[model samples]
Target: MRKLFSYVLSLCLLVGLFAFNGGTAEAATGLTIKDLAGRTVTFDRTPKRVVVLSPGDLHTLQALGVQVVGRPTSATPVDASLQSVPQVGNIHQPNFEKIVSLQPDVVIAGTSFLGHIQKAQSLGLKVVITSGSSVNDIKSSITLLGKLFNKAQKAKVLVGKIDSKVKKYSKTKTKVRAVILFGSGASSLVALPTSFSGDVLAKAGGENIAASFSQLKDYPGYANLSTERIIASNPDVIFIITHANHAETKKAMIKLMSTSSWRNLKAVKNKNVIFLPSELFAASPGVKITNALDHMNKELLKVRAKMKK
Candidate 1:
């Protein structure tokens, strides 16, 4: 009964939001959803031409096997299928003229790029923001995209797979305290409970030390790194997420470890420092959550074994 009501309510919202968008009173095939920015957005039909700006959004679309017409070439694409698509600047800078040239039916974007959303809407293009910070948000966005693209069946299978992975990797007993760090050098940031990686770490049987520090001044989903807090917390594991190429990320790690104060931390002294790719940490876990969890689980198990020994 609840499922039926949800379906009916979704259908009504789809109709209502589309109509509010000035679309045909009776859309041939459309759905309405409130975007991350709290704007009601509607699509007249399942969008065939999509312009993706965020890698997380691109990966979700890819998981649903949705073919994109445009994406940012400046960063790594979701897969080979989306690699050859037209480039729309980079993550921070979008090329409005190029995006307009594509005439995409809808632009799948992240909440971080509000400027891009405004520009696309100004040019009469429907925009949807799907940036997710936590595990639930990522899962909800996945299901929503699946519904929007009429790929409900595929979405179900994909969603099931994600759930299976989460269950398989999730830890029932957390014995290790961890702190997932992003960026490096003086600009280091700590992943809070609100961040995707932080949730993964907690679920993977590792307690996130920084989970309670949400309101860290200017940081939204992250806590401004304070050596004093970290040293006092005395985390058992320190996982660093780095960006750009492997060489660059490795170099940054070298610099991070070279810091005399950081070297004195318990995690550093015990050689529990782990480095991971930014793909799974810096962005919303998306469909790649499984991969990230698998990696963390392996490391956590090793740490547990060592501690027992």
Candidate 2:
């Protein structure tokens, strides 16, 4: 009886020690997370060699201080830290040979790169696709990236900064009527209410005038706006984003504003016509959305002050 009691008490003491040590156990293999596609992606641990495929994903990685082994050639190295990172290929196309050589734990990509994802998966590579269309989608992407890298706290900080900017812009007592015109010469495409820029404008206390009209034929999220409508609606401000690259865009902006028909409008007359940067308006601003919103709000507020004058 004494011998049996000793053995049982030893077992009980071991059980108590284990319980005191925090009963949680890590899986020997890996962990699973949901990407933007809602697909379950597994990771052995936080990826050591990450390949980011888009600017938005780059922003996420930069925010978390995660190591990136590869990136698309087009992605502008935003800081000195990313200047030395190697390029794999363009977002739409990736050099599989180069990626395989790197032996990356996972490849981060934009939702637009489904083909890239398939190709990478075929080569036994892990990929996490992020959705980044609107402000909310960008925030979700940041959160997902944070989860993948175990940098949940950094993700919270990023989301908090974006939310703070949103709250600051959303507090306008009155909405300023605004229109975002794109294209050049006769190609006057306006961003619709459903579009990302349009959404940003609305959030920044500017009412998108183009929301009232149906998208131009097959253009979907965009409609060809005419100078006639500008005269009729008489918006408080006009923000233009041209499709052309480089100096041509600024020239087109000048040309658009120089048209005799647009000169008489109140927005044009009051110097409220703004030509936004292509980085913010044309391509994905990624983590730069916070700065973009701040710039846009400043421009809009300038217009408002001018209107008061």
TM-score of 2: 0.82
Task: For model 2, name the residue pairs that clash.
Answer: none
lDDT, each prediction:
0.77, 0.77
lDDT of 1 by residue, 233-254 (tens): 9888888887656677668776
Candidate 2, backbone clash total? 0
RMSD of each: 7.8, 4.8
Per-residue CA lDDT of model 2 for 1-309, tens digit only, reads: 999999999999877765653332213345689998888998765678998777667866887788798877763335787777788875677888988998999888877777667677889999888876678888898899887776878899999999999998889734678888877755678888776688778777778877777776655568877678767888888888776465687677678777888778788888878888766866456777887787778888888788776
Question: Residue 149 of model 1: what lDDT?
Answer: 77
